[model samples]
Target: MQETNDADTTPTHVETAADLDARIDAADRLLVEFYTDGCGACAAMEPILGVVARETGVPVVTVNPRDDPALIDEYRIESVPTLLLFEDGDPVRRLADGFVGAERVIDFLA
Candidate 1:
């Protein structure tokens, strides 16, 4: 039987700009979520992202720009719950529609 509640399924949090760079550099392909506190849509994505990470075998990470404001400007974020797909340490695609399901998130990565 396979365990379904492993901590690895959960998305890691990026605390700083450097941390974000390091994570993006470490993974060949990564899904980075830009979210802010008190965001209902952002809160809804947590479980979906975990499922996305586990099902797609892609590492997912979340960063609240409030912790490091530079991330907001660096990523050119215009709203909360923006999903960015990074490949080879560069952002290749962006999905900022907000409150997407697991299938949509996985499709975005593809």
Candidate 2:
């Protein structure tokens, strides 16, 4: 029997601390969103992030700090809807000013 993946074809792009390192390392430039459940601002950023991913051609991934508390300290995530841009496995920019428009995100990527 051929091996198969049951996961959806459309990428959810959610990452955990365990695999985050490898994921960022593989991408030339990757966007990571840190969020928590029950956050209104975080919820609002969903559509914006989707737009950023599509418009900028960057692989956007979400990581819930609650799943791995160390991520909070590691990334210095003081708030939800925080977006960090990693280039060559190193974080070079961060957007943690709460919900922002798609244009802002695209500019940040640039």
Candidate 3:
């Protein structure tokens, strides 16, 4: 089940807290990101993650922490570009603070 959005090749927008839980229930893999608009780290992370998402066939949702108030509080994300990889609703990998690089992301996925 592949979906498309302007954001990514297979993008799933998680705008609300309930959307998050619902998505987790239905998807096998979820790449959830907490990003801020003006953050350098978040900007760098997006394209790297875009490639990773396309290559791995993963569903990705990039959320703006500033806008998603509930999500910001729920995840306790202190920094921009916090990535959480979930397998069957369970967290498999978490890259907090910011995105490192494609290689690191690929290594984490592997």
Candidate lDDT values, in order: 0.90, 0.80, 0.75
Report how far off residue 37 is in candidate 1 (Å): 0.5
RMSD of each: 2.9, 6.0, 3.5
Clashes of each: 0, 0, 0
Better of 1 and 3 by lDDT: 1
Give lDDT for model 1. Answer: 0.90
lDDT tens per residue, model 3, 1-110: 34544444555556677778787777787788888788888878877887777766677877786675877777778777788888998877888856588778767777
Tell me each candidate's TM-score: 0.91, 0.86, 0.78
Best by lDDT: 1
Give the Å shift of residue 12 in candidate 3.
3.8
Candidate 2 lDDT over 1-110, as tens digits, reads 22223221112455578778877877787888899999998888888877677666777778888888889899999988899999999999999999899899989989
Our model 2 lands, by Cα RMSD against the true structure, at: 6.0
Q: What clash pairs does model 2 have?
A: none
